[model samples]
Target: MSGGVIGTLGIVVLLVLLLARVPVAFAMFLVGFLGIWALNGWNAAMGLLGSETFTLASNPELVVIPLFILMGNVASASGMSRKLYDAAYAMIGQVRGGLASATVIGCGGFAALSGSSVASALTMGKVSLGEMDRFGYDDRLSTGVIAAGGTLGILIPPSTGFVIYAILTEQSIGRLFLAGVLPGLLLLAAFVLTITLLCWRRPELGPPGPSTTAAEKLRSILGAGPILVVVLVTIGGIYGGFFSPVEAAGVGAGMVVVYGFATGTLGLQAFWQASRESIVTTATVMLILIAAHVLNPFIALSQIPASVGAFLTALDLPPTATLLLILAVYMVLGCFLEGFAMLVLTLPIFFPVILQLGIDPIWFGVLVVLTLEMGLISPPVGLNVFIVKSVAPQVPLGRIFRGVLPFWFAMLVTLAILVAFPAISLILPTTMFG
Candidate 1:
């Protein structure tokens, strides 16, 4: 068989392994290595594996992963996430659907500190779900907000999603980071509007939370100030050109560490726990990146991307039509594949086509990450939905899924807006950096 045929077989074997519960990183690594050995030789495969692993591991830009992850973990350990939730609640809790709206705002704030969507979902779910429940918020709105809002962790500045996309596409991380800012806020606003309309229609879905006194509101804001400052300093530094993305990550991580200890919320035990968690998360991400690197060369040799590009070109579809089809495919895949796995599995084929169509990579990154966000709250494999369920065990899994539906539609609206106005994502990155 030809290299392309062997590559196709390798992908099929990979799907079988994944369905059989193989870990994504290991599964990709295995398929990639074996495919290369089949197409080239064992020596070439082994050589590629060793060199790629070392090269990816040794990449200095990768330092941002661990540092930003550590910053988030430590921030959680320090109770900063709770403070952010409280501040948002205090500011907006009295309005109709206020508590759910606050949860979205809180999730956005925490997203700035924690770039991982899982962490954002888990932490915000814990912090705000109960309060919304207490305010008699509908389970659907309460649970849905947490799951949907958690997605902001991947779209806001300091996002690991953007970081990984940058690494994969060889784009500037700072530019992607900036590009995400407006779109993230736009999505957050859409979520809040969803809640408002829900409450406006039913008037009971999200009952008004008690208003806070002026002093109480001030105190809550003050309480959340330190971590907010850290977020600002890091992101602002990057925007101002005072620091590179790697330097911003280091600064953010360092500041969070100091804040954790100074606040006394992160004791030695908690600190150690956060470190271990960060290390584990970092390792998982690094392994996946290495595996993706290994897989990319094999796929290149397989001519899969070339084949895909030629096929798409042969269709003679308009660029807009082709882009929409690709996005639709991503949305369908999102139902079954975890975002990172789908990203690794598909980008080699799709990214080249996107560029060939003259689409902006940074804008496409936002659209792609938004689709992944949808997947996180989507059914069958909605990771964030499961995370929210774990927080609210009494709420049926089905209810949580139902609750997320409106927010899912809200996400669709945001996606449409971004697609129509690419400038929403591109303005900050282009104006500030260009």
Candidate 2:
């Protein structure tokens, strides 16, 4: 068989395995390893292993992954999320669809602390889901809001996805984090507006939540004050150029720990549990990433990207048109593929085309993240939807999908705003960091 045929077959086999419930990293690794062996021989594959493992582990940029993950675990264990949700609810739960709106606000705030999409979903699902349920909101709207709001995890600052994107593309992590801020808030606002408009039309969807007295509201703010301070210290320090992303992670983790101890919310057992969980989770992610590192350059060496790029250029389309076409393709792909795998696999091909078209990579990264955020709620393989379903099995999966339909439209609107106004992403990064 020809080398090209072997390579293509390898990818086909990997997809088949993935559909059969194989793990993503394992699927990629099996295809890549055997493809190399089939094309050359076993000795060549053996020779590649030592260098691949060392190079992936030795990467200094990768160190930030565990630190950020640790910070999230610590913050969650310390009860920071409850305080954040209380504060957000107090401030906004009086508005129409108030509980749902507060769900979005709380998710955004928790996303800032955690920087993980799944973690944010799980945390908010446990806390805000119950509150919304108790407030007489529709089960669909309550769980759906938690599911949709959880996507903010990657949009907010200190995101793991952004860190991975920066590492893949060699962009500045600090700048990418800064660039995401405005776009994140814009998304949160769009979500709230969509909820308000919908519930206004159908009052049963989210009946008005009980109003908090001014004194209670003010008191709730005090509970959340530490988180706000941590946000300013971590994000503010990075944007103000006072600290690197790594340094910001340190400060954020330290502050959260201090808050936990001082408030006695997180005792010795909680601290130990958080530490242990952080190690396990970080290790799992790093292992998958290392496998990808071994696999990525081999895919690049196959010259598939060059072939794909040539085909895209041959279409003779305007740059904007090409991008729109690509976005549509990503949306279709998101229905079936995990967002992380899709991003990692396709960027090697598409990112080159984007750079060739003279687009700013930072602006494009934010756009890509927002697009991936949709995958968290899209049909067939929406991880966030599954998370909500797991929590509230009584709510049929069909209802959750139906519930997110309006939200999916809201995402498209948000994407349009980002596309039409690039500065919605770039303005903060350029002004603060440049």
Candidate 3:
């Protein structure tokens, strides 16, 4: 059989295996290894696997993953996340729908610390839901805001989404992290606007939170200031050429650990718990990366991306049209696949097409990450939706899904803005380093 035909069949079988509940990394590894064997030979496949595994496993750059993850976990266990939410809430609590807006801001802040959307959703849900509930905020708005806002975790810097995208495309992780800044901020603003409009339309949906006195606001700010300072210094240092992304991660992790201990929030037990969780999360990411490396060579042997590129080129569609079509496919797939799993499975096919079209990789990374953010709140497999449901068992899953709709629309708006003006995603990266 022709290599292309075999490659196509391999992908089909991979999908079947994934749907049948095979682990994502394992499914990719299996299909990729076998496809390489089929297309080349047993000796080549074994050699490819060994070299790919060793190279990926030994890369010093990957240390950033565990450090950033540990920073986030330590922050969460130490109640630093709550302080962030408190700071945002104190600043905006009196505004109508302010609680929801605060939740989004809090999510954005924590996202800067933790790049995992699941972690963001889980942490913010615990921190913000009870407060919103106490304020008599509508269930839909409360749960929905947390679920949707939590998506910023993957779009903001320190984002695992961007990190994985960078490794896959061989783009600069620093540039990708910087590229995420504007788009992430834009999406966060869009969500806040969504909440404002929703509350404006139906005041009862989100009643105004209790007005905070100046003293209370000052106190909350003082309470959270140190951790916020740590976050800003870490990210700012990266942007200012004082550190590489990996170095920034290490600085951030060390500062957070020190803060946790100094404040007595991170006891021995808490520290151990954070370390264990970080290890598990880091291991999961490494396995996916290793699997991606294994699958990449098989895809290249297939020429599937070339075929798709030619098809797109033959149709002579505008670049924007082609890009939109590809993203639409991501949206459809989002209904079924986990975000990171989807990223590993699809970038091999789609990223090559992106480069073939002369698209800027960093800008495309921001746009693609935003779409992945949508998946976190999209139906069926809306990972954040399930996360919110877990946090608020009394709320119907449907209600949480309903709550995410406006924010999903807000995401679409953010995506359109970024696409229309690529500079929105690239300006910071280009200005600082380009």
Candidate 4:
């Protein structure tokens, strides 16, 4: 059989492995290694395995992954995340649906620190769920907000999603980080609006939380100062050209560690635990990235991207229509695949099409990440939904899914707005880099 045919079969086998519950890295690695061996020789496969492993393992840019993750883990262990939530709660908790809105704001703040949607959802769920429950907020709305809001972790600055996309597409990580800022804030605003409308309609879904005194609000804001400073210094340093992404990450991580130690919030045991967790999370991301490099070459050898690109060209659709079609496919796939897995599996096939169509890679990255966020709260494989469920075991899974539906639609609206105006994603990157 031809290489293309063999590549097709390899993809089928990879999907089968994924369906069989194999780990994503292992499945991709298995398919990629075997496919290269089939198309070339065992010697070629082994050479690539050795080279690619070393190249990715030694990449300096990848250091950002562990540092940012360590920053997040240490921040969580140090109670900074709780302080962020408290500040948001003190500021907005008196409005209708205020607690949920606070949760969304808190999630956004934590996302800037964490860059992991699961961590954002899990932390925010633990911090805000009980407070909302005490305020007599419906579990559906409360759970939904946590799951949906947590998605900001991937869209805000310091996002691992952007890091992976940048590496895969060979784009500037700083540009992608800048590109995500406006869209992330837009989605946050959309979630808040959704909460407001829901409370406006039902008046019971999320009742108004108790008002806080101005002094309490000031105290809470002061409490969040450490995290706020870290976020600003790191992200702002990147924007100001004072630091590369990796430098920013290192600085952020160091600052968080120092703050943790000084405040006595992060003991030696807690620090060790946080470091261990960061290492594990970093390992998982690194493995996926390494596997992607292997799989990319196998797919390239198969010429599937060329074939798919030719097919798409033949359709003669307008560029906007074509973009929409690709996004539609991503949305469908989101139901079945974890966001990053779907990203790695599909980008080799789709990214070339995007470039050929003259679409902006940075803008497309924002769109793709937003769609992935939708999937996190989407049904079936709704990963963030499941994360929230694990935190609030008493709440039915179905209710959590139902709760996310409105926020899902809200995200859909945000996606549409971003698509309609590419400038939303492009402006910051362009202005800053230019």
Screening candidate 2 with a backbone cut-off below 3 angstroms (N, C-alpha, C), the clashing residue pairs are: none
- The residue-level lDDT of candidate 1 at 101 comes to 90
Q: Give the Å shift of residue 72 in candidate 1.
A: 0.5
Candidate number achieving the greatest lDDT relative to the actual structure: 4
Tens digits of lDDT, candidate 4, 1-434: 99999999999998888767799999999999999999999999999999999998998999999999999999999999999999999999999999999999999999999999999999999999999999999999999999999999999989999999988889999999989988999999999999999999999899899999999999999999989999999989998999999999999999999999999999999999999999999999999999999999999999999999999999999999999999999999898888888889999999999999999999999999999999898889899999999999999999999999999999999999999999999998898899
Best by TM-score: 4
In candidate 2, stretches whose alpha carbon ends up further than 4 angstroms from where it belongs are 1-3, 40-43
> What does candidate 2's lDDT look like per residue over 308-375, in tens digits?
78999999999888888888888887888787777767787788999998888999899899889999
> Where is model 1 more than 4 Å wrong at Cα?
none
RMSD of each: 1.1, 1.5, 1.0, 0.8
Question: Which of the predicted structures, 2 or 3, would earn the higher lDDT when compared with the native?
Answer: 3
Q: Which pairs of residues collide in candidate 4?
A: none
How far off is residue 342 in model 4, in Å? Answer: 0.9
Tens digits of per-residue lDDT, candidate 3, 112-164, equal: 99998899999999999999999899999999999998999999989999999
Instruction: At residue 416, give the lDDT of candidate 4.
Output: 96
Alpha-carbon deviation at 324 in model 4, angstroms: 0.7
Scored by lDDT, model 2 comes in at 0.84
Each prediction's TM-score against the native? 0.98, 0.96, 0.98, 0.99
